[model samples]
Target chain A: MFNAIQHYRLVQRNRNRAGLGSWHFEWIYKFFLHTGTSRRKYLVEVRQYDEHLYTVDFYAKVHNVNRYRLRTHQHAAGKLGATVLAIIARTIQQDPQACFGFIAAAMLTETTDENTRRFQLYTRMLELKINPARYKVEAFAENSTIFVLPHGLVSQPDALQNTITRYDQIFREVF
Target chain B: MTKYSAKSSKKADPRQQAREERKARNRAIAPERIAKVHIMADGRKLLELKPVQIPGYTYAF
Candidate 1:
C-alpha cells in the first residue's frame, strides 16, 4: 500500500558562494511535482551537524500563475512522503554512517488538531519507509522532532541515548 | 449500605485517557514554533545567527 506513491525527479541547485550566509548548509535540492494544472516546488535543505550527523528540512510552495504561495497540502501527500524518503535515502547513501533529525513542521495548518495530524502523518511515513534494522527512529512526540540514528550505535545504549539527547538539545538551542 | 459515587463508579477508558494526554502534550507546543527554522532562497539568511551562544554548532561562511 505504501509503495504506490511515485516520487518526482530531484534536481540539485547550484549554491551561490557569495550569498552563502552564516548558516552553512551542506546541500540543497529541489523537485517539481505537477498535479493537475498547478505545479508544486519543493525545496530540501541538508545541514551537517558533525562528521556523521545531518538534519534535513524541506517545504513546498505552489507555483501560481504569477507568484509562489506556501501550500502544505495538494492531495498528493503520499508522493511528497515518497520524495522525502528518497531524499533521506540519497543523503544516507552519500554518508553511510550519517544520522538525521528533522521536525514535522505544522506550517499553515488551521488548528492544533490539524497540526497533530500532520505530525502523525510524518511519523507514520518514517515507520513505513525507514528500515529498522539499518537505522533507529526515535520521535519526540511533544515537539514533533524525529531522529534517525545509525543502527551501528545500538550496541552502546548509553551512547545512542546520549547522542539523541545532545542532538535534541542542540536543535532546541539553535532553532 | 451506601450508594456508589458517580465519579468513582464509572471507569475511565484507557484509550480515551491516553488520547487526551497526547492532545494536551501537543497543545503545549505552538505550531509556529515547531517549524521556526525557515529556509529561504538565499539559504537561511533570514534567521538571526547567534553562533557564539551555541557551542560546537558554529556556522562557517
Candidate 2:
C-alpha cells in the first residue's frame, strides 16, 4: 500500500514534468468484496485520497509480447483475449455505487509473433461476423490507454511522465 | 467403415491450390522485429534493448 502511494506520487510528478496540463491524475483506494455466488460479480469500494492518487481492485498481468504488436483471442496460441468485452461485462455487474473505476495495462510493443498473428486473425474474423462495438472489441492499438509504469521508471518521475505522454499521443491518434 | 477413401473427391483447381500454398507460406513467415520504444518523462528515449525470453504462458485459465 505504501509502495502504491509512492508510485502514485511519482506518476503525478512525471505527468507534471511532461507539462501535460490537459491530462488529469487522481489517487484512489478500492476494496473488493466477495459475494458468495456463482456469478463473478464483486463489490468494489473506491476511496479518493487526493487529486492524483487512487487504488484499484485488480491489476491484469502485463503481456510479454511487444508493445506495437496487436493481440487477439486465441486461447492456446497465447494471443490477446476478448478482454475489453469481459471488462464491460464486469462493469455492468459491479456494484453501481462505486465512484471511480481504473484499468491498468503495460506498454505496447512493435514485434509480431505467431500468437499475435493468430490473434489478429481472430479479430478480423469477429469484425466480419458481428458488430464488434456491441462487445467493445477494438483493435489493441486503439485500446491502449494505460501504460503500466515499468519497474525501472517507477521512481524516475521524468521518465514515467514522458512515457505516459507518448501513450497519450497514441491514444489521441486512435481516438 | 473407412471414411477416408469412401467419399467422392472433386477435381482441384491448379490456381486455387497455388494460392492456398502461398497464403500458408506467408502466414508462416515471422513478422519483422520492431523495438518497443518509450519516451521518459524527462524526454529521453528508452528502447527495450534486451528481449527477455519468457519460458511459458503468463497465465492459466
Candidate 3:
C-alpha cells in the first residue's frame, strides 16, 4: 500500500502525454448495490472529475447508470476515501467476505472515448486481472489512478506512486 | 475477524530481526608490495612504498 501521489502523477502525466491539457483529478468515495439476479453484492465506486466540481452521490460520468457515491465529501478525501469504500464492498459478501484474494484496483480507463477506453481495457485486461471488471472504462470516467484497494494490482507501472516512502519502512518494520 | 497482525507474526520477527546490517561501507588497506607511490618532494623522506591490497582480494599463495 503506497501513497496515492504516484497514482496522481501518472494520471496527470498520462493526461499530458495524451495531450488532454493540464488535467486535475480528485478521489471520490461511493457505494453501490451491485446485484445480478442470482448474486447480490455491494461495490465501491471510485472516479475523478474535472471542471465545475460539486458534491454528489450516484453520479454518472457515463451513460444511463449513475453509481451511488457519497455526497459532500471533504476535499482531502482522496485515495483514502476510495479504500474505505472498497472495504465496505468486501464485507458485504455473504459466503466469502474479504475472500477475493489479493488487493487490486479497477483501472477505469485513462484514455478518452468509451468504446476506445473499453477496447484499451480489453486489450490490456491482464492489468485489470486483479481489479473487478464490473465497471467498463467508458462506463465511468473518474480518476484512472491506483489505490491500495482490496483487489489485485501489483504491476510496476500500474502501481500507485506517493511522495512519502514510509510504506517500505512500515513493511520492513511489520514484516 | 482475527487480525492482520496475527496472520503476520506467524512469519515475521526473524526476518525483521535487526542485525548490525552494513548500511554503507567501504574498505581501504594497503598491502605489502613494491609499487610507485608519492615520494617526499623535499627529497629527504623519499622511500619506496608498497602497493595497496584491499580486503577480499584473491592472491596466488
Candidate 4:
C-alpha cells in the first residue's frame, strides 16, 4: 500500500517536473471498499477555467478491484465533475469496469520487468473494431511509449499522436 | 371454522433481510483516516490529522 502511495507521489512529482505548475494538487485518502481499513491515496488536481472549475482525480494502484468502492468513486467523479485517471502497476484487467474511466480515458500500466518500455491503453481504438499497429517511441506517459497492439488503436502517426495529445487536451478542455 | 397456522411458519420479510445485509456491510467497511498538512519551502507541518467520522454517515476505514 505504501508502495502505491509512493508511486502516486512520484507521478505527481513527474507531473510537476513536466512544467504543469498551474494545476493545484491535493492528496486524498479514500477507504478501499473491500477492506475498509486500507485506504488508497489519490492525487486530485484542480484547475480553474473561465469562472468554472475543472478537476482531475487519479489513483496509482498495485492490484485488486472493488466494485462498490469504484461505484462510490463514480459518484465523486460526477459530483466534482472530475476526470478519473487509473494507473496500474501491472497489466489491465480485461473487464473494462475494473478500471475507473475505462470508457472515456486511456489506462496506463507499468511493468516491473521493463526499464524503458511504456504502455498506453488502446481501449478506445479497440472498441471501434479497428486494429492499430504497434508504434514504438519514447513517449512520456505510461508503460511502453511503443504502441502495443493489444486490442484497438491505429498506429498511424496521426492517430497515435492524437491519442497521446488527448492526455494534455483533456486537461485543457475539461475547463 | 377457525384456521390453524404454525407460529414458526413466519418468515423474515425482504425489508428485514435488507436491513440485516446493510448492517453486515456497515460492519465490514472501515472508516477513513485523514491528515491535513501545510507545506512551506523550508518545512512542512500537519495542521490536522485524524480519522474522519461523520454522524449518521457511512464510515469506511
Worst 10 residues of 1 chain A by lDDT: A61-70
lDDT of 4 by residue, A54-165 (tens): 2324343435443112323322332122112222211122222111111123223322312221112222122111111221112222221222222233224454344434
Q: Write the per-residue lDDT of candidate 3 for residues A58-164, one digit (tens) a residue.
A: 23233323222222222323333333433323333321212111112232332333223322232222122223322111111122211122222222212312201
lDDT at position A83, candidate 3: 37
Error of 4 at A145 (Å): 11
What ordering of candidates by TM-score runs from best to worst? 1, 2, 4, 3
Which of 1 and 4 is the better model by lDDT? 1
Which parts of model 3 have CA positions greater than 4 angstroms off? A1-81, A97-175, B1-61
List the per-model TM-score of the A chain. 0.76, 0.23, 0.18, 0.24
Query: How do the candidates score on chain B by TM-score?
Result: 0.34, 0.32, 0.19, 0.35
| Runs in model 2 lying further than 4 Å from the true structure | A1-83, A89-119, A128-168, A171-175, B1-61
What's the C-alpha lDDT at position A87 in model 4?
Answer: 27
Tens digit per residue, CA lDDT, model 4, B5-28: 554466878899999999756532
Per-residue C-alpha lDDT of model 1 across residues A1-175, encoded as one tens digit per residue: 2343344454554443554433334577777767788776787777665547777777775354312124544677767777667777777777888887776655443333232555666655665566655665555654566666665764465666666666666577546
* Index of the highest-TM-score prediction: 1
lDDT of 4 at A114: 23
Question: In model 4, which runs have C-alpha deviations exceeding 4 angstroms?
Answer: A1-29, A32-56, A59-138, A141-154, B1-61
Q: Total clashing residue pairs per candidate?
A: 0, 21, 13, 15
Best by lDDT: 1
State how far residue A48 of model 1 sits from its true place (Å).
1.5
Residue A42 error, candidate 3, Å: 14
